[model samples]
Structures are given as structure tokens and as C-alpha cells.
Target: MSTTLSSRKRKRGLSDAKQSDSLSIELSSLSDTQTGPVLASFPYLTLPKNTPFNVSVRGEEEGKEFVRCSSTIAGETDAIEFSGSANDGSDGAGSRYFLALHRPGSSKLILQPTPVYLISRQVKALKNFKPTEPSSSEHFQARSMLGKVFGTKKAKAAIDAQERNKIDVSAMEDVVGVLQDRIDEGTENLPTQEKLQDSANAARLIPAYNADAERPEDIYPLHNIIPEPEWAALDSLLSKLKNAADDRSRVRLLPNARSDWLRQHLMLAYSSPKPKRKIAKMLIYASVMFAFRGVAGRNVPERSALLERLSPAPEVVVDGLLARFTETPRGSTKARMTSENETNLLTHLFSLCLKVDDYATDTALIASDLKMSPTRVNDLFKSLGVTRLFNVVMTDQLMFVEIASGCTIGKLSSQDLKRLGLPDSVGQEKRAILKAPLTFPKPRLRRRA
Candidate 1:
């Protein structure tokens, strides 16, 4: 029995040895196949804090490029480390990694690709990664931001210069003399009085006026004048008017119920006993009008006349003269402009209607500047040979005026009319004129008287 058990144990030991030898042979084969490293080492990236970026690995599959893995590193993240291995087990051979950076307030994404090499059993890192310097556009954006927070340098300088030029009350006469001298010097190049008069006489005549035409009830609507208020609050209202987003908003700021409020305030200021108060009011009025000329429509003439009637100053007269240059006749008339200045000014203003940027001009803006009713401005433009266009954009009170190139100031040539893209005449019709005279006899009577 003992001899039989020993033989059975020997057989079992031989089977165990055979199994161990087969396992060793399989391990040796695997080692030989994987002589080089099976795992790939990729470099880690260190980025700036609060910088948003993305990292991606790309590889070619079937001759087409594709992303292998991607990760988004948000702002406040500073380091990027590989978390896991890829499933394909190709070790990213012949592949590249890229970093994508986002630009603030823009849809553009900046891509930076880096060539990757598989190194055996070693991790790589960038030793000299420097943050890129800001470009010129970025610098400009930064400067603009600073300007928004603090006023621009140019505005600051202007304010400082104004402060420096402030004068005492006693030097008012000298300042006036200096200003008059400057005005005279500037007018040296303007047309002479005789030339101006000749130009006025030769100017184009307006259309004949019709006495039977009726005027609209709202042609010259009365403004709701407000009494005096705190000067600072008045200034705030003026600022609001000036900074309004659009023409409609500006008009809303001074609706008919509050129209000419600034002028009313100015009159009240003039009535004050203090001369300084009067001057302050005048300056405020002038500044507001200069900044926003379209305010209160072209009723600047009415305001000037009122001021003149109440205050009776040389300044008021000067304001009236200035306003006269912008005023046009209320209705069409055969008469020429009363003054050479008016003719010249109207000619210049009409020329401005022809802009290089647009094919049409908004005559409503022109009418506002000229202080004429829209219908009167339209008539004037029609006399000047411009075609009025319908407002396709549905904007309120917008009258577009268009003139063909090479058209004369007051005449529309047949060629100009054709170029204007108007529909052709249906047919050419001919007509003839006939002149006839009738002969009548006269009778003599003597006895009745």
C-alpha cells in the first residue's frame, strides 16, 4: 500500500511542475513582445490663476483627425494632470496635444498646438512656461476701461484749461474786445458785402405762394412754459435731454407740456437782481442750445425774440441775427431770400443733405436745424429739385430726400429723372395749340347823357 501511495504522489508532483513551466513560458513571451514601455508619459501644464483654458489630445484615425481626450480647465485652476489611460492602448503615437484659450467679450478662440513624443517610463513638464504679454488691442481695451472709470485725459485737460482761463469781473470789457478782434480776423476770408449781395440777387426763386391755402392747427403749437426751478435740477434736465438715446427720447424729455422750459428758466434768471445770475442763465442757455441745437425744434427764433423783448440786450440782438441765418420762409413764395447771409446759409445747409455715406437724407433733421415746419421744408426741397421718398423703415416723421447725380440745384433734367429709377411714361402724346381772335363792332351814343 505504501509503495502505491508514493507512486501516486510522484505523478501529482510531475503534473504541478508541468503547469508551472507552461506559465513561465507564457510570461517570457509577453515580456519579449513588450520590450519597450507600454505606457506613454505626457507633460503636465501650469497655467495662470483665473485663466480659462482647454486641453485636448488629437490623433489620426483612418486618415481623419479626431480628438482622443479633452478636458476643460476653468478659471482659478492652475494645474492640469493626466487622470487616466486611453482605451485604444496605442500610446498616442503620432498624436498632438493642443490648448485653447478664450477671449473675453469675443467669440474668437485661440488655439496653441504642441508636438508630443512618447518617452519611456518618464513624465515630462514644461520648465519655462511664460505668460504671453498683452497685445496692442488688449492694451487699448484696458485703457478704455480706465477711461470709463476716470474721465479721459483730453477731457481733463480741457476742464483744467477752462479753469485757468477764468477771468475777473473787471476784465469783461477787455475780454469782449479780444473776442471781437478774433471774430473780425476769422471773417476776413468770408465773402465781401457786395459779393454777398450779388449772390443773394442771383439766388434761385422759391415757388409762387398761394393765398387760399389753409394752415394746420398744430403748425405752431404753443409750448407749455414752466416756471423757475432749482438751477441744478434744471441742469440735470438739460443733461438728460442731451444724453437721450434717440430723437424720440429727446423729444419725449421736453414734451409739449414742458416745452421751452429752459427758455422760461432763462427769462426768470434774467429777472433776478444779481448780474451774475443773469450771466449764468445766459451761459446755461447758450451751452444747452449749442450742445443740442435740435431741442425745442427751430423755435430758437421765437425764444430769441422773447428774450429781446424782455431783456433788450445787445446779446439778444446778436442771438436773433444768428437765428435769422437758419430761418426759412414759412410758405412757398416767388420772392428771393431777404438777405445774402440767408441765401448762403441755405445753400450750405442744402449741400449737407447730399451725404456720401447714404443715398437719402432725413429732411426732418434738416428742418429741425432750419427751424422750419416739415411741410415747408419739404416744399423748399421740392423747389430745389429733390424727390421726396416714402419712409419704408416706418420711422415717425422722417421725410427722405434724394437727388440724382448731375442734377441742377433747381432743375431736374430728363436724364436725371430717368436715373432716379422712376417708372417710364406710359406713352408719348402730342398736342397742338390754336390761337383765335374775334372781331367786334363799337356803337356810338350821344343823346342819353
Candidate 2:
């Protein structure tokens, strides 16, 4: 045999040798009709290995023999695989072995290798439970939230549609100060960007509530799909990934498939018709990535290195948020999520997007998902964009990226672009030329970290 097998055999032999005794009893002899022994008196116990040996009975009570067990040598051979129960021995438990010994009484002894256990019973089945997800209403009423986030567009347009009074070319410092204060001292531990949006939400709530704003439970009933227990796991994962390393790390979201609850949806979406499923799964992934990159990772983007590693690549088709650029991956379809119905249907994917890839969900897809036309979907994306809905929901994210890296952020800055210490005279000169000031007035700056 092979070396590994030989070693295993050696170990098993030693183990069995230590357990099996030198005596045993063969009960099958009791019914040996050929002998014509009248059988009603005894159990027909046959001591195969030489019997007449001392047997030990271990038990709770000192009086009764809870388990009367004996062992003896039979022959060198392996025991049975399964050991539930049999008519010959006690309810079989632990490993058992038999050793035959002619020196003892009849054949009535056994060893631990083939020894039986006293307790054995069949196992029962587990109970069934309902499936569910988390409730966003606990922090705010879903309807109100939908209205505030989804509703702001008209309010913004109506106010800005007409010529509205422009704020000072500056109080930018005061605006920055209040924002810093909110970031440093306030904000709830919400799974979504709603936490970062206290100021904007309050602006909408004041006129609506007028009185005290209600608590989470009082706002929405638990009937909504998000309010269920199943959503809690997703919420927890999103929260953990958000604070993972830094805000910048938010740019790239590669969630571990084993840990994510949404991976099942991706798998499920691709289970039916192969072609369609592949497309849908890819769209779902893209949609989620869009959310994570633009909507989720805005604040606390400090960990530069980690964020760089996590950031989506230049090739990621993040057309969902911006609705401008997209390229279908090899094994995917040109699908998009465009409606609120699509939003709900795509929630699982959206949750995943909070940290994965860039996607391109548009109004047309939303409309089709809702059994409506692309008009509403287009209108919806537009309004949603202006509201800055969801602290995460960014208007310029994909727009800027939808423009793709055709124009990098570094292009807008004036910081020196250094190359090798000794080289780069020509490139440095070109960079110096681009740094020359154009006439757009710079805005007031916030204090640096």
C-alpha cells in the first residue's frame, strides 16, 4: 500500500489493539437448530473467547448494573462502518472490536473497539421559518423619506426654475463650518447615507412636521418588505464595509462573495434563461457599484491607499448614476434598472452596489420595470439627481464620471506634478503651462485637515 495508507493503518491497528480484549461471547449459537438444545431458559450466551473473566459495571447507582459489558479477542479485522443498533449487542455507540481467547469461558466477551454504547436514538428534523430583510422606516417613515428624497426635485426646480436670489459669492466658509460641525458631532449610525443628510432632511421636515418629528416605529408600519428581520444582516454588512478603512476606499467595493447576502440574488438572477440571466446579473452588479462609488463613499474618504485599491477601475462602465457612458461586459446583457419598482426589485443588488462596481441604471429601465414608459424613468432620474437624495445619491458623481476620466480631477488642480528627481524637464514644463490661470474665479476654500 501507499506510505500514507500504511501509516494510517499502523495508527488504526494500535488504536484497535488497545481497545479489544481477549474474550467474547457469540449469541448466534443460541438458535443453532442442529444442536436441538431446548431454548427457553437462558439468552443462549456463548463465550467465544475464553470466559470466566472479571466484568466491570459503571453507573450512577451502586446497586444495579446499568451496563454489563465484557471483552475478548476475536480476530484481526475492521469493524462495521455504521453503528446505530443491532439485535446482538447493546445500542451500538463508540468503536467496538472483538478478540477471541480459548483460555476464557465460552464465547461471551467483547472489547471496546467493537464495544457498544447504551444510548441510541433517532434524530429529529428542524423547523421552518419565514424570509425577510431590514426596515428603513425605523429611522424615518418610508413614505416621508421617499417624498423628501424623491420629492425635492420639483421644489428645487420651482425655486430655481424661476430666477432665484443667489447666495453671497461667499459665505462658503460659514457653510463649510456648519457642515464640519455636523460631520464631527452629529449623525446617526444609519446603514444608508441618510445619516450624513441631517441638514437637508430637516429642511424638508420642518414645514411638514411643524411639531415634534416622530420616532422610527411610529412613522411606518412593519408591513413594508424592508422592515423585516432578513434585511438586518444586509444593513450590518453595509455599515461595516462603509467604515472599513477610509472614505476613499469607498471608491472601490469588492465585497467577499461568501459573506454578502446579495451574492445569492446575483446567482439567482443568472439562474433562469442563460443569456438573460447573465445580463441581468451584470446590470445588477453595475447598479450596486454605482451606488457604492457615488452614493455611499462620499464622506470620510481619508484612507488614500486603501481607497485606491478599492476604487473601481477606469474601465468600469458606471453609466447608472450619470446615465452617459456604458459598455456591456462579454457575458452580460445591456440591461438597466430604471423605476422605483426596479429599485425595490433591485434592492438586493443595490445593497451590493453600495461597495462593488459601477453600473448604468437609467429611467427607461426603471419605467419598463414599473410597466411604465421611459419618460417617467427619465423624469425620475432627473428629479432624484437634484434632491441629492440619500446623502449617497450623488448628482455629479456619474455625471463627472459619465464624462468618464476624459477629464481627471488632477487636471483641475494646480499642485506640482513631479516625475523622477533627475528627469522630466519637458513634462514638468508642459504641466507648468497647464497650471496657468484661466478666468473662472475660485470659490472660498474650507480649512484643511
Candidate 3:
């Protein structure tokens, strides 16, 4: 009807074949660069060897027979050529060629390259037909033909990059450091508990007996490997995590029966009032992540060993510190934040804690550079604490996911959670986070009595 890109050249019902025998495919007059037409409008017909066919039916009616054609052209061809590949390699690749054929609905078959699946058989056999796109058909074909093309190393490399999102080990370390800095600064002001007993209990959380102050940077890799000697334990665990490709690998390692232990923690430096609670929350998160990493891969035993050896939080904590200090604050505080402000300022800080991105930019941090909480600031940490929980796992654990499974998204994620490699439940309704302006909430000055 229309003579533009939307219009079809041939009439609608011309290609609708009536029966199998009536169909006669002609390809004797094909030129190198031209597409030809139908010889006989039969529902079922076979192509002679070297007899090429091309039908221009971008949008045809439903429930019609479309030819299922696949070809392994030589290195170069005079005919119209296009590359084919799969979304993911399936059935060792090349075992199933899934090109869409002409029929009332979509169908694919695992055809041997030499003896391609016939349209007559495919159409007759396809019971319930579904609509499919050309791209999908192409992907199916490519996936089927993958091994016939690419090398093993090439495929593995592609998988490796995707699973870990390509996060270098050093970058992750930096992000953890930033969170540590914010968490460390935020707890500077915890309203000195005036009540005698409450203060006593609170002091227990932050033990004052620190003759040898432990800086976040001063953790030997051996710290997590206690009870068992460091050299023996680290070597054993490292081997398990590295070699845990299949179930057998994990089975060979790990203890026979041990409580599924995890060492989760949040290492950030925010100016929150209750540093103790923040530290507690950090530990909980680290435990969640540790459990996830421990059980992240193929074997339960290897997962256990990996998790045990992997809770090196100090490096991540140090990295978080460096990331927070690297950025210059955006020059303005006129825009104060409030808890009810629906403008997601505090969650951003939480994301920084989670290492979603490299910068620490919660709108609440718009106050002064030396963000000490003279009154209290733990409210900010509490405000967006739950939201931060998901992020911490998502960002931090993504690397391990890649390392374990060579994938980071899709069906693999649920598998990760089920194995205790990730938290089973997420998005729990925690307390609502509220943003507040950087007002120090200073007490009123007392007049001299």
C-alpha cells in the first residue's frame, strides 16, 4: 500500500502455499547480490544443494509456515552473509540450530548441520506455536553454533569479566575504606549516657581497654585464621576457594561438621552518634557477606573455607577511607536535608558505604568538611541503614559472585542466596530513613547563675 520503508513489495497472500507436493522451490536463476521469489506457493518444499532462497516477509500474518533455514557458509561467500552468536552457550554449542521457520507460530529444532530440519516436518510437528522475533531466532542459531566458532579460553574470559563486573581487588578495598571513615567519624558523639547502669552496658560495646589501639589498616591476613595456625589455614582455605570449580573440589576440602559461621561487618567512617550500634551493624553485614562468600560456589566445603579465609575487612575499610577523603565537597549547604524530605540524600551516603560508586555524596554531608557530631549524628546512619544493607551485599559481593560462578546476574543470583552465599531474605522493612540538614543540634548556652 505505502511505498516507504514500511511498505511490502509483494502482495499479501501470494506466498501462502496450499499443500506439500504443490510446493516447488526454484533457485537456478539466483545472482550473487539479489534476493529471489517463490517458485511454487507450497506449504512444504525442499531446497536443492547450493540452491539458495531469500523471502522478504518482515511482517506476515500469524500461523503461517516460515522456513527454518541454517547454513555454515565458507570463510567468504558471494551471497548475503551475517554473523551469528548466542546469548549464552547452550548444549556445548552447535548441537542445536534455532533459526525461526515459516509456520503459524515459532519453532526451533536441534538439527544436524548436514541434515537440516525440514519445514514440512517442523510445521507438522510444532503443536503449540508462539510468536518469536528475528533477533531471538538469530541468537538461537548463534548459540547452537558457538563451539564451531570460538575457542575455549575466549568463552571463559567473557564469562569471567561479566561475573565479577571486572572490579579490581584494589578498587573494592578502597570502597570499604571510605565506609570505615564515615562510620568512624559519625560515632564521635554518643550523648554521654547520664544513667549509671545504661552507661555501664554501653561502655562494654566499645571496650576502653585499648592499650594497643588497632588501626583499621593494621590487620594481618592471618587475623581471620585463628584456632588453626595462619600459614596452614590460609593455604588450605586459599586452595579450596581457588579450586572450587565443581562439587568434588569443595568436598575434598572443609571440615566434616561445623556450624555455618560467618564474619560480617560494615567498615565505614560516618559522624553517627552511636558508633557502637553502627559497628554492630557493620559486623552483621560483614557476616552476611561472609556467609554468602563462604557458600558462594559449587561445594559447601569450599564455600565454607572461602568464607572463613575471605573476611579481610581491614583492607576494605582502609579503601573506604581513601575514597571518602579523595572527593571535594560540592560547594553548598543551603539545601539542608530532612528525614521526611523524600529526596534521597541519606541513601546515597549508604551507597557510598556499599561501594556502589566511588564517591561519598549523601546530601546530608553538605555541612562542614570537619563533620564531627558534637551533639549526635548516628541518626543519619540509622535513617538509611536498611537501604544500605542491600547495597553493601550487592556491590561488595558481586566480585565474589563473579569469581565463584563466572556470572553476577540472572538465575545465578537465586542460587547464590540459596546456598547461604547470599542472604536468603532481602528488602525487609527496616525503619524509614530520614534526611536532616547538617545542623549540629547544639544545646542552648546556659546563663551564668
Candidate 4:
């Protein structure tokens, strides 16, 4: 009985193990069947092959709760159609489904519902539009109609003239205000008398203004200070100088005989028992003035006949007078003057004299000719060095003589001599030239300490 009971207990243990195995298999099979139906039931949508369309979802915030669909097929009429809800769920009847789009470039997928409306549009044909051409008869008719309305040509011209002259009184005050401002600006820095004189002298130096006046008496200052004979001789000499082609031609033109005649006359005037300082001074002034004026005047072939008459070359005398003004080159231990340097010195001297004349010149006219500003011309004057005296402008050397006792050329102060680029002995030498016959001095090398 004990053996049988043990056998029955073993059988019962085997049966219990078998039943547990069957229960585990049945549970796994049931789980697989439930997962398969859930996966199959997942919502999906398919589009027609090769159909090109753009789908976009409208958010609630935008006052829209639908998806928009747009598509275009060539040669087809554009149409829009709306599709209702895609799915029905237990939670909500007529539930909407969303398709997650994985755009190629986007990092995250966008969840959007299938587009409700499918839209397509067709391109309209272009139309050819052109302006209408007016017929000749139409133009004739228009002109005739206008002629009838406006009356005769004289009447039309009168109407046009009246229209042109019609003034706006309302804008006159504003125009006046603008003009007043311009006038103030123009007159604010009006040039002084000295400045005006300087500008005039500069204008005279320019050929354009010089050509306008033929006689030296009309343009030159202190022209009548000397006697008529001396003045005539000097004017004749200047005309020859103006007609000469070059420095060589000038030298050849004024023979030594003519030069000696002038020299003898000047010496006689100065060495007279009663030497008139005015006559001597006038001779020197007129000679120097004519020399420079000749240099500035335009060359004319018509004046060649006047040049044939014997006249002194004042340029030679003027050269010696101006020799003291040449500057020594910078960084040079010794002063070495060249022909080019002499030419430059003479040019500067001529310019200086012209810039410091005693007559007022129109600065505007000069500035316009030079295509520069009056201020720029003034700057050029300052660079050349000028002195203002009363209502006249003159060179430093002239000013020094003018302010000196007896209004005679005298020794300049050391400061002034240096400022004018002259040697210490230049003043004494210049004063001595006035006492004797004017002659060209020998060229010599200058030494700078």
C-alpha cells in the first residue's frame, strides 16, 4: 500500500508540471495575437502615384483648423475639393488622423493631418498689349481745334509771355529770405582796400587784363611822375622789349648806343648842379616799371615797327636790382646761383611787383579766369610776401623805402634784409645805383655764411 501511494504522488507531480507548461504556451500565443491586431489597425494614408502636391496644417491660433492641399497639373483647370474626417475611433466619432512627415532637411518630424482641400491652378495666357498709333488727320484736327480755342499766334505768344511773367507772391517772402542770407555770406568777409589793390595788380600781370589797356599811362602807377620826353623814351623801350622773341633777341634789339643814351641821360639828371630827387627817383621807377610791364605784355608782330626805333633795355638794369632777392639753396654750404635761378628770381620779382600795385582789381574776374578761389589767390600772395600800406599793397623792399625818411631807397634793417633774401650790403648797393648811370653789373657767385 505504501508503494502504490508513492507512485500516485509521482504521477500527480508530473501532471502538475505538464499543466504549467501548457498554461505558459497559451499565454504567449494570446499576447502575440493581441499585438498583431493593434499594429494592423494603425492609421495610414496613401497618395496617387506621381501626384505632386504641397500639404500644410493650419493651427488653432491662426483661426484655422484644417489642412490645406495645393497641386498643379499643366494644361488642367484649377479646382479645390474638401475631404472629411479620415477615421472613426471609440473615444471620439469622426476623429482626425495625423501623418508624420520626415522632410529631408528637417531635424524633427512634423505631425500634420492629411490635407482637407486639394487645390490646382492653371497659368493664364499672356496678352499682347500695345499703344495705339495716332493718325495724321487726328493730329491735324487736334492742332486746328487748339488753334481755334487759343486764337492767333500773337495771342498765344502773349499768353505764354504772361504765364512766364506770372509771379507767386506767396513765395516772394521766402525767396527774399534766401537772397538776404546769400548777400550776408558774400559781404561778410569783403576784402580790404589793400587786398583789392593787390588783386588788381595781379590781374594786370595776367595777359588778359593787360591786353585791354594799350598805353602804360592807363595801367601803370606813377607813370606821369617823369617828364614827357623821358616817359616817351621809356615807353618806346618797353614796346621793343615786349616785341623781342627771347632774352637773346632782347639783348640784340637794344644796342649799346641806345643803352648809353639812357645811361647818359640818367647820369645827367642825377649829376645836375641841382639834382632833383623826384626826377631821379621817377627815372628809376619808370625804368623798372617798364621792364616788368614789357615782360608781362603779350608779344605782337604789329609793334615790331615801333621797336625799330632806338630804346634802352631797362631789363638789364632791373636784373641787377633784383639780383639781391635770389634765395640760396637749403643745406648748401656755399651759395651757387645759376641762369635758371636768375630767371626764377626775376619771375618772382615781377609777380611780387604786380601783386602789390596801388590799384583795385576785380578778384572775382581773376578767380573766374584762373578757375580758382579768391582765397587761394590771397594765399599765393602771402606765399610771395607782400606788405600792405594804407589802401595800397607793395613789395617789402618798396614798403621799406616808402616808410623810410625822405621816402628814398635806404638801408634796410638786418631783419628785413634777411627776410627779403638779400645780403647785408644790398640796401647800400641799391642806394648807390640811384646816384650813377644805370648799367648791368657783372654776375658773381654769392657766398652764404
Candidate 4, residues 8-118: lDDT per residue as tens digits?
233544555432211111111222112111101212433345543332222232323222212111222223222322111222234344454455653444444432222
Please, what are the lDDT tens digits per residue for candidate 3 over residues 329-372? 37932222222221132222233233211111222232121133
Candidate that would win on TM-score: 4
Least accurate 10 contiguous residues by lDDT in model 2: 401-410
Give RMSD to native, each candidate. Answer: 30.0, 31.1, 29.5, 30.2
lDDT value for model 4? 0.37
Give each model a TM-score.
0.18, 0.16, 0.15, 0.21
Error of 1 at 135 (Å): 79
Q: How well does candidate 1 score on lDDT at residue 166?
A: 66
- Candidate 1's C-alpha runs over 4 A off are 1-242, 245-249, 252-348, 355-359, 362-449
Q: lDDT of each model, Cα atoms only?
A: 0.37, 0.31, 0.30, 0.37
TM for candidate 2 is: 0.16
Q: How far is candidate 1 from the true structure (C-alpha RMSD, Å)?
A: 30.0
